[model samples]
Structure formats: C-alpha cells, structure tokens
Target: MTGHGSGDLRERPRVLVIAEAANPEWVSVPLVGWSLATALRDVADVHIVTQVRNREAFLRAGEVEGESFTAIDSEALARPMWKLGEALRMGQGKGWTMMQAVAALSYPHFERLVWKTFGADLEAGRFDVVHRVTPLSPTAPSPLAAKCAGVGVPFVMGPLNGGVPWPKGFDAERRREKEWLSYLRGAYKALPGRRATLRHASAIITGSRHTASEVPDAFAEKCVYIPENGIDPARFSLVADPQGDVLRACFVGRMVPYKGPDMLLEAALPLLKAGRMRIEMIGDGPMLPGLKAFAEAEGVAGQIGFHGWLAHERVQEVMAGCHLLSFPSVREFGGGVVLEAMALGVVPMIVDYAGPGELVDARLGIKVAIGTRAEIVEGFGAALRRAAESPQALCRMSAAGRDEIAARFTWARKAEQVREVYDWVLGRSEKPAPFG
Candidate 1:
C-alpha cells in the first residue's frame, strides 16, 4: 500500500507503462506509443517497458536503459512471428488484420516476461498503477490486466482504437487490401483472455466512440474515451493561410482505395477543370500511377500537384500552405493526420466515421456523411464548393481547429487527461470524464 490510494500521498502517481511498439524514430502506432509514454512522465513517476528493438531509440532520446526504462527481449518468439505475418500478409500495406492476428500470438510472451520481471515489485506496491499503452487494437488482449488486478495494483489498458467495422460500401477496397481476416474479426470477442482483460482492468481507455461502443454494457462505467492520437505543437509550428478565389485543398494519406484518393480526385474534377480549386496530393502508393493517368486524361493535371512521399517537415510545409485537409479515408482507427493538419490551423474535411468523425465538428472542421463511393464523391464535391464560396468562414474554422487541438488534443493534454484516469483507478478521486 506504499504508493496506492491514500498511502504515500505523493503529488504524482508512480506508473509502470508498457508500450511494446514504442519508438521515437518510427511512425503510426510506434510514434503514438513513444509520445504518450514520454508525455506521461510529466504527470507521473514513470518507468517505460518496451521491446528490445526500441531500446536503441530510447537511449538516443536520452532515456537511460534499465533506469528510466527497461527493454524486454521477446525477439525469440516475436521476430519469427513478425516474419510469418509478413509472409502471409500478401503485400506491404495490405492484410493489416492478418498482421494483427500474428501479433496477438506473439504479444503474450512479452507480457509474460514483463510479469516475470516486475511481478514482485507490483505485489510489493512499488508502483501505483500499470498501464498498457500500445498494441492499441481491441482484438489484442492483455494478460497483465488480470495479474495486476490480482495483486491489488490497478491496470489501465488502451486508448484502444481499432476494430471499426468496414463501412457498408467498401468491400472491394477491403478485398484489395487483403483484409480477408476482417470478416472474422468479431471472433476476437470470444477469445479466452478478452473478457478477463476487460473485467479485471481498473480502467479501459477507448480511443474512439466505435471502440467505446465495443466495450460490453457490463463494463461501461469503467470505460473512458480519449483518442490515442495527439499533436506535438512544435512539429506543426507553421500556420496555413489560403488567400484566393480558388480553394486550396490537400490530401495527406496513402493513395489507396479505402483512403479514397481516387474518390477525392473524382469529386474535385469539376472544381479542378473549372480552375476553381487546386489540390495537393502528398503521399505515394500503388494507386499513384493510376491517379496520375486519371488526372492527365481528365486534363486537370495542372491543377493537381502529385508530390510523392516527403519527409514529415516537408509534408507539414505542404499542408501549411493549404486551406483544407481533405482526407476521405473510410476506415481510419486513429486519424493522426487530421490532428496534424488541424494543429497547423488547416481545417479538415473528412468523411464522418470512426476516428475522424469523433475528432471534428461544425465548429472546428467539416464532416462529410459516410456513404457509398459515388455518394462520398458527391458529398466531397459539394463540401469543396461550399468551402470555396465561403472562404472567410473556412478561415474562421481553420483558427478554431487549431485552438481546439491546442486545448484538448496535444500529447501534453492527453497525458493530463490520462492522469485523471490514474487518479480514479488509484482511489484518489472519482472516475473521470475527460471530454465532458
């Protein structure tokens, strides 16, 4: 009881943070893991536990290995599992569900090692709480949850954001991405440790409403909604200022089917042809060549700038010059790009579903209704025209988006919100409602 509840009376709680995928040098989930874990240091007495692979990055970032953090070497099982996942996934950027399925098999080894390494300290109350901040997929169950609960040490899991069902009209896109396993994704709920993981966790942080909805009604009271993605204001220091009759819109994602790069192109075709809007496409993928051909064939190539992948700074520079982040991805679990764009005072125009839908509103940004491909194109097209017609209103939304991100969506703010959850699970305060 040293650090638990009303025992120690320390200003900051002591937390052992588990983030298997944390790496400062990486992107997506790894970057998210690194950011959130490090940010939590500001609000807690923190010790990070990550995989052996991220040890070098942690050292480079000034984290003293074995002091500030500990690296669990589960490579004996993890490396082969990852290679098998790669082999079965069919291609890069496809078969995401297959990869996660493989990961679920290997992650238990990591957690087992964690308990072996830290179990005694946990039972002795060396740390106030144990938080798992990575493997954000809802399908991945944590064995540590039950272990911590058994020890009277609170366990917090997630901002878990994945498992958003594929929309009604995008089966073709799903198939193209080799997501065959997605059809059976629901079966994870019946997996052995899932119920115990939810049942034993002191707090469950749902990263999106869809993920929140996935938590059964029986455990609803302990669930808290806080998106896994957050903006680093330093990286997005530039501000966008679009000053012209033509709408300056940008799309920042993979040029793939579900991302709807083609849909965005088709939607903005009339605007591009009429010289009323210019689009900057800022990523590369299998669809790039086809998109190029379509733009050239439509005679709108001049209005669309196709910049294949750029460095993060360069991407921000491109987004900073634009007025809107027009992303139409239909199946994002965490719309990190939308947050990045909003941080730069760039209003987002995204399809209203999953992560992006939960992030935006009429006050900060625009949301197109989720629908079939044709309907999405029409929706995006009309949204583009309306934005063009009301440039001043768009500018106001841009500023509002930046303000909203600063207040509620930065990593620092996210860490504080998480601290509130820590307080609740530790019995120092009541359960937290971070957003409300």
Candidate 2:
C-alpha cells in the first residue's frame, strides 16, 4: 500500500525497531541503538525489540516492557557464547574481532527468536517497517531482512559500519588490538545469508563510505548514507569557553595504541613546552602509564592534565573548558566523541580519514591528513600551531561547529533523516539522497 495523497504528507509509519544491544546506560553501539530507536518514536509509531540484557535499563528509562518495547531472551545461546568470547578474548578489551566473531555466531539465534515472536504481526501488516539498528558491523548478516521481505513488509538495516581496513602503517597496532578475524573480514560477504540480507533489505543504510563501498553493485540502488553516531543536545548543553590564553585541548577515548594518545602527546610536546597549549587527556587504558611517564619525562606534566575516564558529564565538563579536541586516532569507525566535542563548541583537530573525515570539514574544524606515525605527528603539530596562531579562526570554528552539530548531528536530526527512508520505503516519495 502506498502513502497519503501528498508524498510528504502521510500517517506515522509503524516501525518494529530491532536493537539487540540497545542500552541507554551504555556507550558505543548499544547507545547508538537506544538513542536512534527512541528518537524515531517522535516521527513514527515505534515499538522497540531489544535483547533481554537491556530490559532493566529500558524499564529504568521508563519504557513499558510490553507496550513500548519487548525483550526477547535469546540467552539460551547468547549467554554461553558471551562467556566463551570473554574466556577467549586474550586480554581485556583486546581481541575485539574474536568477540565479534562470537557475536556473529550467536546473533542469528536472537533473530530466529525475534522472527518467532514478531512474524505474525509483520505478515498481518501490523507494522509498516522492520528496522535493525544494532549489530552495527557490516560483518553481521541479518536473516530477518529476508524474513521481512517474505512477509511483504519493508526491512531497513544499518547505518551499518565497520571493517575499516587498518591503514598501511598500523600493523603493529593492529596486532595489539587482537584483530585476527579482520584479516579474513571480507569473507563475511560470502557468508550464507549475506547476499539475501542485502537483496531483501528495502533500504540499506551505510554508516561510512568504506561500508557503503562494501555493498555489492547488484544491491547498490537501495543504499542510504547516514553516519552511525549522533549527539544528544541535553547532555552536551554547555558551550565551551575558549577564552584562555593558552590553547586548551582535550583528547578523549581509550588510551589504546590505535587511538594514538601518545601520538597526540608527541605532536603537542613542543606546544606544551612553549606554554602555547595545555592538553587534557580524558580516558584510561594500558597506554595511560606510558603517556603519563612521557609527560613527566618531558617535564610538561604540569601542562597536561590526565583525568582518567571521567563520567560522561564530567568528561564534557572538562571538554567544555577547552578550546579544541585533539583526537588523532588512526582508525575510528564512528568518531562519536568528535560530534560531542563539536556540539559543545570544541572544534576538533582529528586525523582526516574514516569517520572524522566524513564528519568534520574545513568549515567546522581541522582535519590532519591520514599518514604514517611521523607524518601524523608532524601534521597534528602543524595544526596545533595554526590553532594557537589564530584564536579568531578558532573562535569562528567553535561557533560554526556547534551550530552545525545542532543543525545536523543531533539524534533528533538523525531520526528525521531516517524518517525520509521510511517515507521512501513506504512508496510515499522518491528515495532520499542524504549525501547529495
């Protein structure tokens, strides 16, 4: 069935949002799932279906278990699989590929159960759309896509992102992250249900250009480009005060090898010594000790304040007092923190590749070209110098970045973008070209 007479004018589409990892209390994929699904409620009649693990969080967030959302317990398979992944993870927060491999193995069981629970309603045309918001990795194929297609309902999957190949010089970093499965990551495209998932999805929302490129030529027509990360304005309401004489910058994220916290220090050392910049390091990991040692060894410890893993609000509080976010991570899939910094009027100076490249442009913030370790350090150093030399330009970027975040990167704005996909899939209008 088509929509109301005017394509732009239509009833609220009923959507069954499947977010197996959705948790309001969590960060990353779970937060992405929870935020986007709830935001969609403003534009559509949405009923969230999430894994049992997030049930309590959902209830705490005031969602009615049965009416507003449903929790499917796939724990029979999921629990054991999770335990196995933990046991084999090699080290804490390492071996991500192994964990995701374990997840890919267990997730289908969840979907099978989701189909068992929601099949009837979908077949009966009770919902206008079936949207899978989690398992954000493009590596995980959805059998539910084909199932929804068979039931004659539209299926939307993604903003699916991941499989950003480690850049040329980060092999040592790659090994440290325990990304063994990534070597064979492309093989997921050949997995049993992948083609069917892509072929059947009414709209495929890709979160990055790398992910969008992964879509087979045969199914490219249905793809939509929307970044996976967005900021909540309420949480990041404080505007940054960039009035300090020294350029104050903050680096947020796990102090892991790939995140390049050390690289940031190497680049900023000259500025720190000259008292041209003061850096705030937020977050903790194995690299924290080394970073602190480096700061002390350089005698610039006083210039760099290391606040290890502050609460989200506190992180923003620290960030709000700063002028720039210096995040030079070599590999990032979504770069959610960049958006958060922008929302707070903290202009980001990030490596111009992958997620940050897509998110920040010349107008909003600075982009250091992606390169080898030395090149990146030099680039970030130069960018830091430029930021210091021109406080006027920095102030302009502070205002522009915050304004851009409000206009485009908020969860509410992202939901409206998804609504356009809903309208297109329901035959209400021409397909949306979000990039164009």
Candidate 3:
C-alpha cells in the first residue's frame, strides 16, 4: 500500500485526468474541472479524458480532441436515464437534488469509458498517475482505482468534497430548498463500489473537514485535506478602489432558499433605509420574485439593485464595484465566489458553517455564528452595521484578504500543492506539506 522512492526520479509526472465536466463554454464544476486540469499541466504532462459533451468546447479552446484530450461518449448510456430524471424533477419540483442523483448514476459510465479507452496505456505504464478530477463528491465511486492498483499505476481521487450537512439549525431553509435527497445522501457509502474506491485510491484528497471525516478509518492513512475551490488570478484581479462614505454590499449567487439572499436583504434593511449602505443582488434564481417582493415590502427596494443573471466576467465586475460580499449560504460546498471577492479586495461577511465558514477566518473577513434563520439575519445586520461604522477595520480586513488569496488560493499554487500529493504518492515524500 506504499511506494519506494526512485533514487533519481523525474520531477514531472505524466498524468491522465478524468474530468466528466471539463468544458470551457460552461461554468461551475465544468469550469472548475477545466481550470484544475490546465493548471496541472504546469506541474505534470497532462492528458484529459472527459465526456463527449465537452469535446467541442475543448477543441474550440485549442485542444485537439484526440491528442491534448480524449472525448468519451456517454450520451447513449446516460440519455434515457437523464431524461427520466429531468421529467421527474420537473414534475416533483426539486431539480438540484434530483440532478445530483442522476449525476451519480451517470458517473460510473464515464469512469468505465475512461478505463476502457486508456486501461491499456495505464496497464503498460504509459502514464505515471491517474487522477479523477470531477464528480468530486466522495459519494460517487470510480471503478478505475482497483484497475490502477493491479497495474501498479497510482491513482488520485479528489480534491474531493461534498456531504457538508445542513447544520444543527436551519431546518426551515433546508425544507424550503426541497432537499429530500439530503436525507438519503449517506446511503452512497453503501453503494457497490464505494469501499473499493476508498480502499484502493493511492491518495484521497478531501476539501472540507466534514468530507474528510467521512473517509473510513481503514483508508484514513492515505487521506489528505486540500480544499477543491481555487481562484483564477487572471479572471479575478486585485483592484482596490478608494472607498466612498456610502458602504456597498453585494450578494452574488442564485437567490435560492439555502443561499439566504432574502435573509441578507432583511439583514441589510436598516443600513439601506438610513442611507448608510447599498445592497446589490447580482444573480437570478426561482426566488427572484419573492426576494424582490420582500425588498419592496421592507421599503428598501429602491436601495437594492437587482442585476439579473450576469456573465462570469460581469459578475466579477459587479463584485469589484462593491465593498463587501454578503453570502450566508449555509450549505455551500466550495464557495468559490468568496475567494473571487477576496481576490478583488472586497471583504466577505459569511455564515460560519460550511465552505465559506471553512475558508474565511477572523483576519480575512467576518464569520457570523450560525443559529436560527432569524438569528443569522440579525447577526448579519449587526456585522453590516459594524462595517459601516468602522471603515479602518474594514480596510484592514480587505487588504489582508487580498494578500491571503494571492499567497495561498491561486490556481497555480493549488496545482503545485496537488503536485506535492503526486510526489508523496510516488514515494518521493512522506506526505504532502500540510494543506494550510
């Protein structure tokens, strides 16, 4: 289960990246997969194998499909089931959870296709490592780990992250978000290939303490904690405009129940009415109508600007124009937007629970203690008031946040950290330097 170091080893390893969602034209996990895969090219000779849906986008991005990347067609295998899931989701009205279930069902086929196409090269030692970068959930099992083990090729899983529970409170928000599937999330461990994937993985990289805790005691030795979310320095540049007397706060995600945008709106109402602050809502969701209505009801609608869905770059621009990012989503997995805000010198005010709670520290920004929904709203309002009254303290935190991200959270830095894990797996080191 351990490897011996090569006396005079090559520093750069050849890696096969299995990313089901690595597409440039798309955002979210697809963008994450694409960014992570490309970043690793600086530390390793990388070849990516992803689903066929991403093929055209990769080609458009200047990667020749069969060479720089290989497209594995999964449409035929997934289409029927995906359609059924979609139809059921529409009928039942809880698409996100249903989509996760559908994705879990389809992921094994993508991994199987990856192995079938590249299993020979892996068995023949053409690649130094096999890293599965997508379906980053610890719940979704990959079939190729055991095959890699048998062939003596090391396999890496994750920066894998998921299963951050709905915190002790917030039952109302959870129920409103239609998280029926959250109740069944734990059953994934009992799935057919779950144990073997964990058992045979040469290294298991977890993103959060919650997911890291889920790794069984037997495979715990190989588990390393490295957050999966990272910032793209090129896209999210540091731009600190001089602060005006009017403090501007922005909430930049979907306006969903779990995301807590309405809670934020309520929290900032006092500031909005007193002309002490401005609130910008920069993304659209099903809750848009309700959010708008609530703002109007509170008589602060004029103080809040609803910029319905923006392009990725535009969203950053909106964020940069603001002073603080108010994101209290209690169930976020990566909270990449938090890092993006920090990259631009905008301090974040986040709830202390899941991903945002894990990333933001006292020095970087404020973490409101989690409590009942009303408590959270009141806490956020108090935090906003503190910022309005203390510009110097806010300035200090903003500078520190920008500095923190440049040093630790950039994509290149994250890639280097992953390379350390690769080296450790190849027997070049005892373990990756602590993922701070």
Model 1 vs. true fold: TM: 0.96
Ranked by lDDT, top first: 1, 2, 3
Question: In candidate 1, which residue pairs get closer than 3 Å at backbone N, Cα or C atoms, i.e. clash?
Answer: none
Write model 1 residue lDDT over 1-436, tens digit each, in one string.
1111222234788899999999989889999999999888778888899999999999898888777899999999999999999999999888999999999988999999999999999998899999999989988889999899899999999989899899998999999999999999989989888899999999999998888888999999989999879988878889897667788999998888999999999999998999989999999999999999999999999999999999888999989888899999999999999999999989999999988998888888999999999999999999998888866778788889888898998999998899999999988888886573
lDDT (0-100) at residue 379 of candidate 2? 97
| TM-score of structure candidate 2 | 0.97
Misplaced by over 4 Å in model 1 are: 1-10, 434-436
Total clashing pairs in model 2: 0
lDDT for predicted candidate 3 compared with the true structure? 0.84
At residue 167, candidate 1 shows an lDDT of 98
lDDT of 3 by residue, 78-195 (tens): 7877787777566343556667777788788878888888989988788999999887777787889998999999999998887888887777767776677787888888988899
TM-score for each model: 0.96, 0.97, 0.95
Q: Which candidate is the best by lDDT?
A: 1
How large an RMSD does model 1 have? 2.7
The sequence of per-residue lDDT tens digits that candidate 2 reaches over residues 1-436 is 2111112335889899999999999998999999998988778888899999999999999888878899999999999999999888788888887888889889999999999998988999989999999999877779899899898899999999988888989999999888877788788889888888899999999999889998999999999999999999888999998666888999999999999999999999999999888999999999999999999999999999999988889989999989899999988999999999999999999998899899998888999999999999999999999888865678888899988888888998898899999999999999997662
Model 2, C-alpha of 39: deviation from truth (Å): 0.2
